[model samples]
Target chain A: MTTSFEDFAAGQVTPLLRYATVLTGDPHLAQDVVQECLLRAQQRWARIGGLDAPGAYLKRMVTNEFLSWRRRFKVHSTLTGIDPPTPDPAGRYDERDAMLRRIARLPRKQKAAVVLRFYEGYDDAEIAAVLGCTQGTVRSHISRALSTLRAADRVKEAL
Target chain B: MNTEDLIRDALRRQADLAPPPGPVLAALHRPRRRRKPLYLVLATAGTAAVVAIAATTFSRPTADAPPAGSNRPPFSTVTGSPSPTGVPSGKLVSLEYAPTWLPDGFVEWRRSLFDHGWQRTWRQAPPDHSPSAPALTFEITRGSIGSLLESADEPANRTTVNGAPGVYTDDGLRWQVADKLVLTVNLDNVPDARGTIRRIAESVRPDRRQIRVPVSFGGSTRFTVSANSRDDWTASTDVSYRDGRYMAMLHSVAHVGSSPRTVTALGREASYEEAGGGVLTIPLAPDRFLSVGGLGLSGFQQPVPVETLTEVAALVEVDLGVDLSWLGV
Candidate 1:
């Protein structure tokens, strides 16, 4: 007999959520990604249920959702002035925040590539699998993202 | 700081950071009757089973299988032994070429084989080795390799392993290894199965180049072992079983991610597959742990081979050192 979606949820959802968090970086946003992925998987569990690695499907869904969310919001290409932080010599946390802000400023694909490769510790091929692109594309994203991070004057000053 | 290093640290910290609150399982589970289209269902179901099976199947028979393009006959010995008397004689139905063995106390449901390249065979365990394990299931087919590959989708990605290319699809992620045969060590299930699978795959790695460990009852049963492990622990081992005895032991380590203690601890919990209206969890501690037993009450086929199973369990223990926990035999 086929396993119920409820049982599948109990067995598989948390791993997806954990993965979503890595993808979106916002727990709330990750929730949306996870929810959307779940809905998609549920609508087609009969097929996914039989897959050797349903987890991979869920991952692809989450990554795609995150990318789509970015496009829908048109959040990329928006520039913000790096406000001079309140002076604190020892609070390296400010530097971290500045760096995060800079990373946040990168284009969506590049950010995803960086997050997937460095944050998730996925190899180039895994990053490609998650991103639904080729390994060369994944490398390109990483390369472009590093360039953007390097060009951010605030990041350099903080370093 | 270098961007790569910072990126690495940032990513590590991200993994450590509290994960965001995303979709809950409760929210994901939708009632049936609202399911998606038929093609999706077929596509998905077809992908899962076919991918995992293919992932394990298409590799070298053993770790020592001849390297790619070596032009050497991968088979070291023609060891296909004839079936013994009283042995179930039928089509070589389904054969799951799993390098690993099943944990003690785990019983395969004997049911009618239909599609999925499965054929029915003797339901009873070996008389002398009753309760045989690690329980493995395999099926052979007369179709072309493409027929099997088509059963599943193309692998997720392709790579070269030791100058050979291997198409791989497992769980969800798909990839191909080139150059050399690749052994997938999940490190997330029963240690015995994991170790056995690794060992079996590695045994034929060299000249044999296949992951399938061939066994045959011959004169004065002799066998070989091949292994690869980190400085701490090995991941795979191969041994020959004949005349209720183990002839050789081969061991190997796959990926070097953590220490043995970490791996041992990681291997504790049981990852289950839904079977027979219940879940089967194979524990990973104290080798030969019980998976499910006492089938006398669990509604098994008649002529319950309780005695045979027990005998197999004992033989496994004596030969393989499997610690079959008291499973209410």
Candidate 2:
């Protein structure tokens, strides 16, 4: 007997949502993606209920939903033009927090590539599988994203 | 710190900040999927069964599976060992060859057969005396090598393993053994791993096996099986079981929208919904459900009894294990 979608969700909903949360970088949105995916998964439970790695399948679903989430519900909540107080001559900004802020500001695909590659430790092929793109595309996404991040660091160090 | 390390640390901290697991689960139980109306919602773990209303004619095996080149077909080892009395049999699998030999201490780890063009994968324990992991794994996919080539992060080098024409890459050794069948060996760490890989490739011979997951349902719920996925995780299938003239056509899935009629289907709380009684939706989660739709369930000519749908759901066994290791829960 194949697993019911409910069982799969009850068992997998946590990681699936967590993966979605990080992938989307928002708790509410992660819940939305997981719910959407589970609803879709329930529709195909018969076909997918028996795969060896249903979680992998659902993760991919979450990823696709995430990409769609980006396209359909692009967040425009940037704090534009809000200049911070001048740093006291001896005061250094928290580099880690700055790096993370920049990372969060990355475009959706690049951010996804970063999270999947570095945070999740998935290889290029696996990341591509999750993001539904060619492995080469994943490489370029990472390369461009890392380059941008590195450029930011270089500018800070020069200052 | 390096960018990667920094990103990893920040992300991990953020992940740790994920609002408790119990909340995550509770939030999904809230209604939403039923309200959103959009096209193209797809994702994956092992197999993400997608449901659409397109009138797709059922094709045996997969016709869209890109044709594996004539010379090298893919490999899918039959699942499960033989019953100890008969030869190893699996569904829709034809092994062109089995290694006449394997390195000592190498044992079968797992085997998977996919029904969508039915790709196969087999892994064996690392050869004894080898330190480190990324064990030797074999993957056989049926369809176009173009998809494989397209997904490759590195370019493939045209070469032959064991005199069999194939492509070599940092990815692994890939070659199509028969028409529409491509085989690959992922050797992570071993002495002269490539050489041993080639030897193993050479030893494989055509010893095809076919096995099918048997299905049996009791009572008036009897039906034949079709359009079933062999991917092992969910084994999600599209079975249109017929009880003589009375037929029940159902596939597994989650809910979309509208209220539901609850039933104890197959010993679980099945939330059932019908649209004009043409479509039957069985809720699996808050926003997820399995739908039995099409001309059969719709009662186009005659209203399909809810009893038929319930029986069909009952016949399906939903036995599965879910892993949340990634969730850290």
Candidate 3:
């Protein structure tokens, strides 16, 4: 028997929304991303309904959306001669929160590679699949992302 | 100091924010609105059904499962028994690709998405050795619509479609249009059985006029377009609108490698020339409309008249949230 889209979505939307929020940093955009992801998933409920891990597919979509948004932002930013705005300074927040925010502020690929690697605990191969790049590229993204993070950390410490 | 520690903390924070109760289930079953496009229905049906099955088998707990360790939840659980939600299962399908039907003069082509599954990628048909020939392209992707399009190498533009924000970009080499509706076609996979897929892909084009959607939504709209038999490709849209400003959030798919029957059953088939080869009207205002043709096209040009359309008109309501005046063109 086929499952109802509403029931399946009811159980999964929250976690997926959470995933989208982390990827996009903006709550509204996150909601938009989740909405788009879930909406699309709803259309294909009958087919994808049989997948081994449906959340993996949705998560990939969320990541792709976040990547797309970042690319668009970069294009617009380039046209306006604006680099991504500097991230706000870490206030009384914990070091981990501060570090994660700093990581979030990196270039799209780099940030995703880092998040998929360290935070999501995905190995290099897994990160490669999610990011749709060669494992070497994934490693490179992680390397660059971490270097940027570590550099920022040192700078923060000096400040 | 390991990177995983930092990443996990952030991921946990992200997981904490969930969709509000009650609305979550409805949001998944259908778009948050009433009206819908065929493509949305196919894609959503595919996704929702897949998730439900996965949840049943994969979410089962195993006592001896691996520890949660540095990760969290559902560690190495044994697969469970089927808890079918009872939605009718459509035919298991495959998409096809072929290089010959491409008109003669197109410069280059590449396939972005292809696999033996319900989804297929979109690309333009090749030009017939004519410089003025229009580009042809199609896309069949299943994730973030924004991400699927923006990741391409071509230059894209950010603009609003009928007031909804989106990106528009293309280059002469190959073209891609990704948003709620994606367009682009590849030449390598069409089988003899998939001619209908090619025909549908050839039919997609950009539209000039704007079609209005008449629906109320703080909900969602799920739309889909698929390629089926040699002479048939079907497109569908479904919306689940809740009370809100956005009529319905839209999602669409253009399948190029499946049979018409398969496409229709899956909800990915679309009719681009239904209302003439320019605009495929949704028949529901403030509800949905799919426009194909004009300045909005990329790749080898077929008839792409707004295949998956949606609208979110701004509403001016009083303190009681009752309608005062509807604001939108």
Candidate 4:
């Protein structure tokens, strides 16, 4: 049976959009990217609908779109002045918020790898397929991201 | 919490930021906007004429051309037409080399131009929407090929491409096409892979056509402009000072964040941010925005002032009517 594009998009758009949002750190851009990918997917639904896991294919498309979007946009910013989240009246800070900001500043592939592992619960092999890279490269990206985050945590503690 | 737990928690929280899918679904059914092509083909004028003359003069094969299946470098420098504005265009802005032929049924589907080099991909069918779908990709870089066998699980075999030394591994073929240029061709799930890859690599020649972009940067002569474009039709031109302390980027897509602080620029309201670097985003249309800002590369240097960014933003020219159907979504 050939599944319809509308039905596929109905079931998959939420997860795809959520994944893109975390990957891009910008919801509006995520929407644009997801919508673009879906539109293309619709044009080729006859073949795509026949796949065993169409959602996985769409997810990979979103990941690739975010990766290429960074290159096309080419917006460069420094990492020096990322402001910490507001402190509570008790003088405590939200470390999660700070971590999110740091994640936002990671290089594109690293951030995507981190998101795929932590959010999607994807193994290195799965992430590798989505990224169109080797499993070793995927591990390297995640390891580098963790190192940067840990180093940032240490600096915060010292401060 | 441990870093892993913290990352998981943070990502879960961030996932809520995804907007509801109603609008996206609605947009899918709406009629797509149609626009005339923005590219101006002045084939008989200015740099186009020069390119035409050069191409004709260089049409004959060089006497030293390597024989078929010979292992030698087959590339010769070819000049392309320049943009009318004297902005670097054509060979200066496009890929240095492109395959003159491909196996039957292969079609060029995507190309990305960057500051240093470009990448082009071809596939057997257009309907393969999955990113992991089988395709052939050709990439050129401005630096060393850098350990062609670095990622090879098996020992790489030394080979030749058009008489030039190359390394062939399970992953792909890599060769130094020129002193500063390296080329790699990757094949995935293609029929007769080895012979096809060799034939495609051997057919590479100088391609000097200027890539068309949806927007142009006329900002300042003091800043050198580096333009890049993607197959999706989204393009950007980044202008930076020689010292790299200040820069501005103009994109054909809007990148506004939530609850952005608003200010005035170019007689219109714009979203502004001073953190990391001063960023001024002015909406060009419902779907497009222009961003202009730069940060200091050195620790002691400060970001460009907001006023300067506003001035730079004023100098951008955008074409809202450019056809964007290729964006796929």
For candidate 3, give the lDDT: 0.36
For model 2, how does the per-residue alpha-carbon lDDT over A1-159 read when each residue is reduced to its tens digit?
776454455456645655665665544345446766776777788888989878889888777665664333332111111112233354322444455557766888898899888877889999998888999999999999999999988988899
RMSD of 2: 20.1
Candidate 3 per-residue lDDT, tens place, B1-329, comes to 45456556655544332222112223333332335322221111001111111122122122122343623222111111223232321111122222234443433321111211112222334212111223233343322224323544444444333333334432211122333233334233223313443344445454322111111112211222222111122222222223211112211222111111211111223333311112222211121222222211011223222322212111100011111021110
The prediction achieving the highest TM-score against the true structure is 4
Candidate 2 per-residue lDDT, tens place, B168-253, comes to 54424666666656566645445466777777767666555432322112211112221111211112233434432111222222
What lDDT score goes with residue B96 in model 1?
32
| lDDT string, candidate 1, B93-138, tens digits | 1123322333344333221122212211111222011111122222
Between candidates 1 and 4, the DockQ winner = 4
Alpha-carbon shift of residue A124 in model 2 (angstroms): 1.1
Off by over 4 Å in 2: A76-93, B27-329
DockQ of each: 0.09, 0.11, 0.10, 0.16
TM-score of chain B of 3: 0.19
What candidate 1 gets wrong by more than 4 Å, as runs, is A1-8, A71-91, A153-155, B11-23, B29-329
Clash count, one per candidate? 76, 66, 142, 7
The CA lDDT at B162 in model 4 is: 75
The prediction achieving the highest lDDT against the true structure is 4
Model 1 interface CAPRI class: incorrect
* Winning model by DockQ: 4
